[model samples]
Target: MKDHETLGERLAEQGISRRAFLKFCTALASLMALPPERAAAMANALARSQRPSVIWLSFQECTGCTESLTRSYTPTLESLIFDMISLDYHHTLQAASGFAAEKSREDAMKNFYGKYLLVVDGSIPINGGGVYSTIAGRTNLDLLQETAKGAAAIIAVGTCSSFGGIPNARPNPTGAVAVSDIVRDKPIVNISGCPPIPAVITGVLAHYLTFGTLPDLDDLNRPRSYYGTTIHDRCYRRPFYDQGKFAKTFDDEGARNGWCLFELGCKGPTTHNACATTKWNGGTSFPIESGHGCLGCSEPHFWDAGGFYTPLSAPVVNIEAATLGAAIAGAGVAVAMSSLDRNKIRRAQQAHEKLTVKEL
Candidate 1:
């Protein structure tokens, strides 16, 4: 691949028409919550921009984040957009290994020093001089410090990299720490999901390519467009929750009726992510839609947030007074509805018995 070629040129070579590229840019603009008018601007910027070098560093992780990105529907615009980036070094994706792989990373750092983007997945262990994980005999801590020094920006790609994930959960034997916990100087964007939404990962990259800066982030350093609201607020079952209908058991009538799963230990009320909206597996359905309550995988310390089946009323933190009041009111309404439903059933049974006696 020619290093000097613009993204537009590269896309043209791949037979991707200009119209398709523009459409892709428009989608990206909408994804980022930018105004419709900015789509053209984004298109122009990306067309002219050079493919920036990206060095991906993996540490103590399951490679699920990598799977999410690569398995994002093939031939889709998002996949194409990812392809446009000059991914210089990725442990899993690159063919080179041993000293050759390390050399590739070093070369990219040297070539694009102070210009490259560093993407990280997985937590760095600090216990025992970072002996928990290493690459080519160098500790993850050493590699991260060395690689991060010259990058223009960093993107922490999953819950592991952003918030230490399961490794940093309670009884964290590895003494795992997030990238932000270690690299304080760089402008880091946290895409915090168990394995984050793939489109979200690409969206962040597109934003940088278009606007030449990181997207505005929330207090947790997460892109506000993706992590601005709690899943419960946007869930389809939200109305059921407000109306006080809840599923007590997975096979109960309430479950069959598609009632809210709040009583079934859904962490959606406290979890801030786009899972309810953006969804997963080509927008098919989320955990709640599949009958399983949210595990709140995006939020920090979720692994240690108590049992996945534990009711939110028991161990959930930061329950506002208004929310508590709403829950109480909803429960009251549910009790009244239940009583009315029972009365109607009894009346129907009584009338049927009367008719049976008359026939006899």
Candidate 2:
């Protein structure tokens, strides 16, 4: 590996203008929940420190994670490479294959060992001596263990690597297991999603490279900033859910009117992810924004959890009562005007209120 370039020189070589680079720094500071002044400090730290090397390992996965990452071409390729961490070896990205490709990975580990990041996208099948997935005539189990030995910190990239994924489904033939199951000693951070949001993946890596440590993680080892809040908390259709206006069917009036998708098997309330907040495809929209309910792909065991069209949970508390109580107390004039000659509306309101009271 060449000598590490200072941030200023690196950014210059990467062709990122000073102003744009600073804006990137500002975004990073905001994402990290740090103060605006922290941007300059982060810039200083980044300028002095070397660009961290990253080795991406793919095992029993569908390449969805890589697809999500490559779709990160928002502003430009320079943005992805210069701002986020550097990718030293990615079998998918690297042109080399066979012994040459394996040598490149070995070289990266040797050159940046104890400092490079190890990102595994799929699970390791230990059944039958790991013959399920092999590279360069070696099983994934052997390759992963060998790579993890030299990594400074390990990041299980997708649900596959984080939680055994679909390969560990019922009547398992491969006996797949997550990286955490095998490498129990290292600092492993799991970004558990079918294919986690691109921003979140890069955000975590950026946080580690810039801040020199992993961000505060939840009990499930997800970064708190990204996964701390539930999708329901930041949902744009929250008003509909609170108002008890749900889409009963996919093509119903409620769905057409952009109402909530809770009744139709939305897992938003229980799902912890940054999809609703950071968004996808350059902050344009997410699944919920597209009029579809969340599948809870980010949570563990989400695959076998339940159908996407099933209610997340039975309402233990009366949501309608609470919403109506606020409305009747505050919007008295509107309620009074609309209360008359609306028997169906009034009855529905009362039924919800009664349910709420019953719960209480």
Candidate 3:
């Protein structure tokens, strides 16, 4: 593959039409929350831009992130966008091994220095001189530092690489730490999820390619477009929550009726992610839609956030008092609105009577 060829040229060689490419760009723009008018701009930028060099590093992870990305539907636009990038090095996906693989990585680093993108998917173990994980006789710590030195930016692709994940959970024996905990010099974007949504990964990349800058990030360094709202706020069962109808157990009548799962230990109220919208497996359903409560996998230290089946209000000592306070507040708002509506109706009736007398 010629490095000089633009992405559009490569897609053309693959028999993809210009119209298809533009459509893909439009979908990406919508996914990234970009304006409809920006689709043409995105298409132009992507068409003219050179394929960026990406070095994907995996550490203490289960490869679930990779699985999620590769299995993102079949021949989907997001997957195509991912393929457009020049992925120079990835341990699991690359065919080369041993010294040959290491050489490939070194060559890419030297050739694309200051232009490559470093994508990391797991936590780096800091214990015992970082002996827990190694590649080509070098620890993940050494490789990340060495690789990030010349890259334009770093994308922490999973909860592990973003927040230390399960490896860094309570009683963490490996002393795992996220990439941000170590590499403070480069711009880092966290796509935090147990295994982040595939479209989200592609959307962030598309944004960077189009705008030549990283997307706006939240306090946790995650993209705000996707993680801006909590799962509870967007959940289909929200009306049930407001009506105070909850499923006490998984097999109860309320559960069958699709009521709120808060009492059943759903972390949706506190978890921020795009699962409820983008969903998984070709937009079929998320965990919550599949009759399971959210585990808050996208949040940092979720594994240590108490039981997955425990409600947020369970651990709080003032559960009754807090519930009462919330109910009273809601009631007060409802009453105020009702009073305003009544006053408007009474004034309208009085105006009609005055108009009748004036007419007479």
The candidate scoring highest on lDDT is 1
Clashing pairs in 3: none
In terms of lDDT, model 2 sits at 0.76
lDDT score at residue 278, model 2, on the 0-100 scale: 82
Q: If both were scored by lDDT, which would come out higher, candidate 1 or candidate 3?
A: 1
Weakest 10 consecutive residues of candidate 1 by summed lDDT = 314-323
Model 1 bad stretches (over 4 Å)? 74-83, 314-360
**Candidate 1 local lDDT, residue 218:** 71
**Cα RMSD of predicted structure 1:** 12.9
Better of 1 and 2 by TM-score: 1
For residue 276, give model 1's deviation from the true position in Å.
1.0
State the lDDT of candidate 3 residue by residue for 75-154, as single tens digits: 36444534467777889888889888898889989999999889999999999989999988899999999999999999
lDDT of 1: 0.81
Model 1 CA lDDT for position 21: 79
TM-scores vs. true structure, each candidate: 0.85, 0.84, 0.85
Cα lDDT, all candidates: 0.81, 0.76, 0.80
For model 2, residues 1-360, the per-residue Cα lDDT tens digits are 244455666777767676776777787776666788888777767666677778899999999998888776332345556544567678888778788888878998998889888999988999999999998899999999999988999999888998887787656699988998999879989998889887778778768877789888876787878876667767889889888899999899999999999888787766778888888888889999898999878766556554667675433233344446657777564664344213322333343334334433
> Looking at model 2, which ten-residue stretch has the lowest summed lDDT?
340-349
